[model samples]
Target: MNNIHLLDLIQGASGALDYVNSTVTGHHRRVGAGAAAIGGAMGLEGRDAADLVTAALLHDIGAFSLDLRLDGLDFEADHGDHARAGFRLLSVHPMLSRVAPLVLHHHTPWHRLPPLSDPGPGQADTPAAALLANIINLADRVDVLDQVGTRRVVRERIRQIISHNAGTVFAREAAEAFLDLSAGSEFWDKLSGDWTHVREAVDLPMADDLISHDQLLPFSRFFALIIDFRSRHTATHSLGVAETSARLAALAGMPPESQDRLRLAGNLHDIGKLAVPVTLLDKPGPLTQEEFEAVRLHAAASESILRSVPGLDDIADWASQHHERPDGSGYPHGLKRDALSLGSRIVGVCDVFTAITEDRPYRPGMTPDQSARVLRDMVGQGSLDADLVALLLDNHAEVAEARREAQARAHVEFERYRSLRVDGAAHAA
Candidate 1:
């Protein structure tokens, strides 16, 4: 329950997740580790910086899929779901309540998203989380472009990725900073461009990262609680969504294994928002351009976080692709409908449904009718599939009932918390 305990839990959880995703996916891990190092070097306190490193390491914690065959994953889709899964699992744990939101919304963009800033000194740490998210973001690009601890080719290739993003994927500030970091020596090369020298440069976390599936899953579940702690409104949002979405997906005829992955993806769908400022998250007014820009980064943040794991690429792929629309309106990647899979598409709808139906600090949960109207509009706009919307509408009663059941569990938790409060008071006597 103390910060030290929480930190230990986080370290174990993150290290395990990092091992699985990195080993299985063959994407870089040290970039996240290195990014955390930069934050530590930049004067973040030991715990905070280490937490950042763990976050950096396991941010993509949702990307691994238990059922996914490893050969199908390239560097692209496998590790994407880690963020959402990671956030939801952490949200339920004690002491880690604060990190929950950052883990959830680290990919959150500024402006008109969940965790909109609220007016007050009592508002939580969304902004600080956002700052760390930004640091991780730039660090991710820097690591990829520098190829972190790898060869020069990978770094050069990273520049090509940045160039490709041009006006999208990254904002000018993010791009500019990344470009500056990309400059200088061979940091832009493959992860081992300086293999002989680099092996001796600094101790890497790889060995510690090696982990079994059983060890990794619980660790991931732990961080899910941390992500939910980011915002009062979103505390249980990811978990509920994942649970209900998986149930719905199965009811809608998805296979058991597919449903499992969907559940994982749904659990951490909003993992990136953890990095946004709480002020912005709870803000009641319209956001300035800067704030809005911050909101857009959440999905990308989610994607980067997931990439650090070992074998969870399938999970990451589906989860990270949720924000991406069929019409190429999504952030992180302007992936159009063709690029997205059936699982990813289902997640997109589930995320929208849960986000709107759930209470937000800024607005009331939309009525089913209201949520339906908006989703219908989205379908017409080519952002969503009209047929899928219709299917969801048909299943509205089931979805609502499921959500209510989940909410009831929270009421029980609330009562338990109240009981603890009373007990603690009596004990003080």
Candidate 2:
């Protein structure tokens, strides 16, 4: 295969930053293209543009390592370390080094830097990499809001949201420019990435390994079921929440495909919990410090296991980032504010609501009213999205009914489900 093809494969499989990649499944390459177009529009030219494109493609590599070790975590793992790890791993690759630092600190934010070369110890400060790093960072956030396809929103919806977030981290000019471009007619269609190159690119074994959307759905559901299977305390937890969330998204006028993705993400949001020891997950009482740290690794773990499965990688961000907080205090990646995709953000709220409202091993479930109150408090604190939370609360009665119905459904249809595979070979041929 050619070098470009090889690099895209490696980057795609890297699962580093969790920005625009496969964590959302059907939207994987499309999100990457969005980031790239915005980067290009920013006048990031030549090798710099390629680097941003490369970084944009594989920003979530840190997830793979974190998820791999989660299934039986004996120690408290800090997933925030993934950005640096992804940077290091790609630094060794000839094609990816330019993008490595960009990917590394995508989670660390541009404003909170101590300089790329820390004056103190050998620990390098990565925040001062370059403007491209910052540019790609903003682009990632823009695509996540994705004002497209959801009941014919105003063209300026993305702009309005970005306009509201001008200070602190994102510059008013940059955000406004992104909004300016996104408000145009052709941007949304082009934002999803230029797939013509991918189609015409030279073929390879790995390219043949690409997983399609259909194969991933069942796998995603089953993977989420594994989260419940890990302990009686959490059995069917994700599926129940998934059904609830999907039903809610449908009610709120989200497109059918987007709603399907939300439900799938809700179902698998806790798959990272699989790597956690049953001892820690099933504890009858509150977790110790060390134990809580172990609990945080599951999201990272979920990201890892799903990375290898090709087409399903986008779901990783949604399924895995379910626990991320908007305030930068959440675990896995500490992805604050606009760093999260809308689907992931929605799943985050749904995960909390479903878990709190459902029966648990240690305590009685919170009433829907009580869970609504708690979710409201979280929104007030910036832990969840107020808008999505409001949507859920608005339809809580109907969602509660769906949750009731999902209780009897198995995560899969049993006899019809099979292991996920890709027709990469056929595609290549």
Candidate 3:
């Protein structure tokens, strides 16, 4: 695999979060821009400022459910739930360690926040991380205010809100920096433009260098969590698919590196589902034609999102083509068997297997015999690759055991995620 651009990958993953609702479309970008501008005014530059923008882009990532995301639009809402969730999700990943603490405390009020030195052993230096979190808090509120009303009206309202919240809801220094930037037309002008302008306005570096595929795994898992955790119906779907795909690739004698790539592809395959409504995903009955069409778009949407980052062309194709069929009966591109790569076929097969065997809100999982029959029917109809289907069915017990173990581990994580409200409560008290 080629080295992937870190910023592009970060931005691409961020885009998935912003895709969940129209109210949040470009919301992350706006906050990133605002935080970068404010961070600059407060004398933050280089890695500190860049990490601020990264945290801003992913601040709402913990709001996995549509309900949690929608609730965020309420300026007075308790954001502790998602804040803790985001922190836990990000803190476990090495690449996002610096950004994690900021995300955890982004909604914590300046007065209520613990001392700067509290983020002990192995944590990011808290003085900077704490300030950066508050900067993000201020920037987040500014964007939320900007979301409604005319530009002039919104700007005035934002001015009043910041002024009212300063020194309490916001750190005094961060609030002052925001006010200073808002005092001039240039800051808002740069904000009104693209993210590129916002990055340029703050002198944030955009690293163009690529990193190894191994370096991208944490992010892949992160994206998987974001994609799957949106609904209980899919809490472990991506992980299951990822495990099944990698296992299938190994059974097919694919190279270890290639197996890893397929694993990543599986993790990201449903990223486009972020654009899909939870109502549709969790519906108990069959989808109407319109709803089906909306759900079907996720494949193409996944391709579009993954393709935006460089060095992910193969990943994009493998992920997007999971819905494609040998008989050219699948969606998005509807390519025939000849057009599909082995990697794509593996993902497609794994997706089918996982979907059939996983319990859903509407139905229980099929037994192995039942699942085998279904797979045979699919292969007979040219819906799945005959060879891959046979390989899975032939090794059904091993595959099923592997998928079950993977999802069991995922279930532990999901339980921990769901239980974060307790953590939030303890912290609040």
Q: TM-score per candidate, in order?
A: 0.52, 0.48, 0.91
Candidate 2: tens digits of C-alpha lDDT, residues 269-315: 77666456767777887898999988888788778755644445556
lDDT of each: 0.55, 0.58, 0.82
Best by TM-score: 3
Q: Model 1, residue 56: displacement in angstroms?
A: 14
Candidate 3 C-alpha lDDT tens digits along 1-429 = 677777778778777777786565777777888898888788887778778888988888877676665464567777887787787787667778667778877888887776544444555676787789889989888877777434434686788889899989898898888888898898787767654534355567655446678888778887887788887788899989999999999999999998999989999999999889999988878899999999999998998889878789999999999999999999898899999999999999999999999987777889999999999999999999999999988899988987888888888877775664322334432
Candidate topping lDDT: 3
Candidate 3 lDDT for residue 192: 72
Ranking of predictions according to TM-score: 3, 1, 2
For candidate 1, write residues 309-376 as lDDT tens digits.
Answer: 43456667777777888889987789988888877888888777877887766678899889889999
Q: What is the lDDT of residue 395 in candidate 1?
A: 85
